[model samples]
Target: MPCAMAIWRVYLLPLLLLVLLRAFTSLPTQAAARGGADPSSGTDDGKHGSFSRNLLQDKPEITEEMTRGYMSNSELEIAVQDFGRRCANVSRVYSIGKSVNGSPLWVVEISDKPGKREAEPAFKFIGNVHGDEPVGREVLMQLAYWLCDNYLKDPLATLIVENTHLHILPTMNPDGFALRRRGNANNIDLNRDFPDQFFPINDDINYRQPETRAIMSWIKQEHFTASAALHGGALVANYPWDGSRDKRKQYYGCPDDKAFRYMASVYSQSHYNMSLSKEFRGGITNGALWYPIYGGMQDWNYIHGGCFELTLEISDVKWPKASELLVIWKQNKMSMLNLVASLVKTGVHGRIFAADTGRPIPGSLMVKGIDSKISASRTFGDYHRILAPGESYEVVASMEGFTPKRTRIMLERESMNLDFILDPDGAAGQTKRLPRDDCGCSCDDDGKPFLIREAYLWLYLLVVFFLLVLYLLFRRRISSRLARNPPKRPVAV
Candidate 1:
């Protein structure tokens, strides 16, 4: 028996090990054979295509059977147009630009004052950033219809529609959706096509995809306060900094980390069972902490556009069954509404004006400790600064050729209105002074002239005058005591 065992170990054992190794190696081959084989993936620019991790491992190949009930590119456009006509009172449909394959990127602007500038916050909801993640597109359409259907019926919807300009882009990658691929017709990831802060790969504006260029131009044209892009394959509200300077996987937060966290919490807590997530605490995460990726849309929106953006991964399954889309929409409806309402419901909002002309001035806003700045709208001079409530902040409003004004406040749960009326810097005999609170502040108060630059000298003279008055009062008190009692004074002498 020992001799037989020794022979088995020497010969048969080696063969068994070889068989196990072959089985282990064949697993990847089987996976690739199942979904990763795409023949028409080469870019229009004659470059080889590379698939994202979601395309290969996270999501299976999108078959026709899986996308039966989903809307085609043309169908989505028609639905957008139909929504515009149906909700003509509060919605307008316009095309931002076209896709690589010449598909118009339709946008539905829903507001009480659509296409007109108002002293209100503007929010954008971009869906279908990735062509395969069709859930966002469907859910966004549902959001639009729900808002239209419940405009005055539901208080939340009414607040969102009446107070905020809600822009909905259902599909950013129509060509990719048509191809049933992750990237656009050029086989490039739209999310990664934005200019990155850490890496300069996307710095060349000429090389950007058409869809990316459209979004960029839209941001430049409109002053959005905050925005969110919907995605799938995970369930978390992702905030920036998406990539670290060292390119390491760690928690790298943007300058407005607290504000971003609060914004993320608002979405996660509003979602059904999102805050109960076990994978992500509070169902929110910093983007880089999860895994660093450069050139993400979330960070770019914050950095370049001054728009607080959240990359919301709303579904665990990338390409869920079409039947499940409604359920997903129901799950995230409140989150979407609350996120938009947050623009008006919370934070600091106001407009800047020139004191001399009493006209709106397009100024910039900044917080004392936060290393970021946002600009007011050119048309209305309105600015909205989203901050974490229950904290104190020193808000500053500044413009060129005008004196900067600042005020400190303890931001409560409700939103605060703090407008500034900056005086011309060349104005003479005006002492630099800040207003006491968030109420409107101006250089001139009730036709009273402000003090000149010799403020400290005036303070010194006032102190001396006060001292003289105190001395006189003390002498008067002494004389009154003497007059009353004749001082038993000399009695001691």
Candidate 2:
């Protein structure tokens, strides 16, 4: 009986414990893969994620066709291609990746020189994150078409087309749209699918949906000064930190809280009625303050891509009548244009170069008080920093091997272009090494390796436990042998 019990304790106990641990950890993974929370309960948008989708969904099926008069996936592609052909000199169409359902994630680069690199800031707009909230997709297409039609004719459009590279991804979740659900074909919410600053959910890149991965890859390749994602269900501009550290719902702001607030307010104040919202008090709420959601895209963009992103809930209704999309586009047009134009119209735009060789140096821009830093372009050493129109800011440009340069610029309502030629930190020609973003510890993704190290501690603990089990098993066998034979009393020595 003791032998049976020992065998069970030595082998079955560890196996059982292992099984329990795996089951414990897999709960959130399973939940996330299945769309994290129930969309029917309005958990996707919380107070601001979705609008009265329940009431909309309650309508008769006969009205479905009328409500969905928005462009089909194929129709949108045709529109994109037609615009590309018509505006070939100013625009180009390209695909970032494919959806789980094999629909292309198309992007329209609207610029004077669409595919070329210039000393200009890049801005991206991602729409149709949720399949049910199709307002963003239609509005984005309208935005693209409007830009294509008005470029060289409209001053604002001409400024954007000539000075900045605007990348418009009309629909990010075609699979979700095709399925008419909040999540993708895998039923995963793409917005809640990023690696969270608080929770380590979706840390592994593989588990991220194809659409999510495509956006991640795109941002990594492009240095966007700022960007915004379009959403429906609520009329507000949402900024991060999306999740609080204590997992509580409250106003949790990141390092550049004021800048984010300003960015969000830019959208809300520019909108037709967003700034008049009674609930959000300016139609802009800190994401976590609205409701804590882990693994959101806005926070990830700010943290990893070094881009300022606003999650704009542009409509109070998730799926309004197709006729309302033009109104929606009109409402958001100025906000969108002004937001992108702010990159080139205001703030400080500059290039950093080596003082000795007169060569461009890929440096980073940082305001003395602001905690965040923006890396300069590798090709042109160009950097664009967006600040409120009227302010006196002491901006600093830094490179790894160079002595950082500081310039006090009193930026008025117009843009300031300040170039820096940094001297070597020590010797005239020698350089000091600085950290790279691709290092195992990247500042792009929150400079903390604390989470990964904490996760590794579990493997270390498991290894220690396995060693303890082996040691105990050996002792138990020795004890049983000694009990059985008494060890011959050491031959009476």
Candidate 3:
């Protein structure tokens, strides 16, 4: 009996040991199957021990069907290409530059008229400077498709494409997009990389990667008149003159300052519920490094490039669901159209000042000569008239207690630093003032007073005429001088 019991213990003990070893070996695999142990994960530290239990109890399954509704980077590219192919007349896909990962940086040029590219002012719509904020790209693609499909049927669409060139670069950071990250492949924030007046190169938190360089190069080459960069994680429309800590910063009211305010006001009226006057609040004040940013794209666009650029923070939450796309599309579509449309027609922009004091005059009317469109100066005494380019027109200013002053001008070139002053009507109680023609010279038989004609044209002709006459006179003088004083000839070569 003792020998039989010893035989049973040896066999059973070996089997028990083998079973225990197998169970111990499978523990790590089971832990990994439950999402593994990530020390840096936002979950609690002690939770690692119960990972397997929690995962089995609370894990949510992500089915393939759910993912089919949303777009990946590759899928988006294919869709863009297909859309371009369908609307061959109005849309064309071109490469802006190559991404760090060797993918072509795509730009879709959308216009209704095929042959009028150069004759139009271009409005650039860019998206996804931060790879994680991909909604902008989707919105841009939708805009392109809507414009192309509705060009013939929609009057506004036809007018916009015919008059303005729409350049859309859907994804600026393709590499970061592929990785589903905010920073690019090199871990650089493209927004903070722009070469601003503050920083020309990457320093501290500012890092310019290849993607930003490509964008800067494209902007320089294209010379876009107006543009907007789309961002996510905030629900507001941000405009330029952003470099100062406060809205009252000195640079905010500089020479081109009126232009910045006009841009901000236009964008606010079009899209978001916020006002340009109150956009700077909380910690995220205007464009200043008050938030510790070294360089930013919007500031660079305004200061360095002379193009009016704004940052449109389109969503209140990050990674917005697919359903929110259409809502955003509807909200921004008209505002975007209006911004581009305003650049067309004719524009009158000048400074108004007090006739007596030579100080800025606020709330004055600036009427376009050709279209007779009126724009009013803001409290800061700056005004801009949006009209058809390459058209000649006059601007008139009228204020209370001052004589009306008018200036004939041309909108062929971008005008700058135009200042005006109104004069008082005669002395204290003269009642009747001298006519404007008296000071300017005489009026024609048609009663039209001409202050100045195309003096440059006449001056150019006069210079050429004078030079030709002088050439002839100089030739005769030289011949006469030679007859009077002949030069001595050399004896030999």
Candidate 4:
């Protein structure tokens, strides 16, 4: 019985170990199989798979006939093309990206040097964030046309065209507009699709909507100084912080609260009747004070892109009659122009240079009281820092391995032009590089890379484990052979 037990330990034990190893190796495969088993499962795969399934199952199809008078998706595309051709000198139209339903997100860039880069600030106006709020899309198109016609004709228009790059995305949610819904075709709200400060819900880039991703990518590429998204359902201009730390319905302000309030007032006060709103004071409201929401694009722009963005609720009633569209455009036209003009009209505009080399260096600009900073452009070393005017601010310009320069300025109603020539620090010899965004490299998405690294690690472990098992098996077999046939006892000398 003892001999039989030893035999089992040698041969059977090895076989048992092999079975355990195989089971261990198959775990990933089993998990993958289970994941693939239910193709229609409501599991979010970070891309469009899960949402696409949900769209097909739950949402109702909207036909072109249902949306009359308004431009169809194809018509909107045609209008963009026509504008590009008609306003060839002042405007250059381009597509930022495509939506989930494969519609191109078109942008009409209005500038004297339309497609060229300059030391000037850039401002973007995104319309139709929610599909059902189609007023913005229409109003934006009118704004584009007005700019095209009035450029070199209208002083304010020429000012914006010559001094700043104005990018207008007419319909961010074409898929949602086609469906006539608040959310996109996948039933996801684009406003709530951005990365939230208080929550990690939208942190995964893979799970983001194509429209939201497009906006994020565009912001990185353009380096906008300030921006606004046209929405409906209210009449006041909204600014960050869109959410609160405690998740309560209260007035939670961002670091640049004063500046944001000024920006919001620019839009609201410019509007024909926005200032007369009894619901919101001064025709402007803090976003969180009204109602807190997470993953809003307005707050994300301020935090991540270094752009002062306002959520402008243009119309009190969303989806108003088609005829009212023209009236709405007329009402909001000055607000749009003044907002774009604000980048040039009221802000601290400057370029940063290396004192030793006399060459432009991408640096950062900050105000004394403001907690946030804006980066200078790599090509021109130009930075546009928007602040509430008529105040004294100690402006600081900083760069890696350079002695930061500081200046005290009493910024007035007119925009202030200030330049900084940073000297190389004697203590720090070599110049340290700035972050990708600061260095002018486009860091589009924020998705983490741990999954890929983990996958490689598991593969490495599997290869090592298999080799270890093979080595043990070979050793066991050699030991058994040596035990069965021992050499002639070394032929005793």
Best of the candidates, lDDT: 1
In model 4, pairs of residues that clash are: 46-206
Candidate 3 global TM-score: 0.55
Candidate 4 lDDT over residue span 172-276, tens digit each:
999999888878989898887777767654337878889999998888777799999998877999899877878777999988898999998888889899988
Model 3 lDDT tens row, 293-342: 43567766544444567777777654566787888888778777766766
Order by lDDT, highest first: 1, 4, 2, 3
User: What overall lDDT, based on C-alpha atoms, would model 2 receive against the true structure?
Assistant: 0.78
lDDT of 2 by residue, 93-143 (tens): 999999999999999999999898888999999999988778888898888
Model 2 reaches what TM-score against the true structure? 0.75
lDDT by residue (387-416, candidate 1, tens digit) is: 999999999999766889999999999999
Which pairs in model 2 have colliding backbones? 45-49, 50-233, 51-233
lDDT per model, in order?
A: 0.81, 0.78, 0.59, 0.80
TM-score of 1: 0.76
**Where is model 2 poorest over a 10-residue stretch in terms of lDDT?**
38-47
TM-score of 4: 0.76
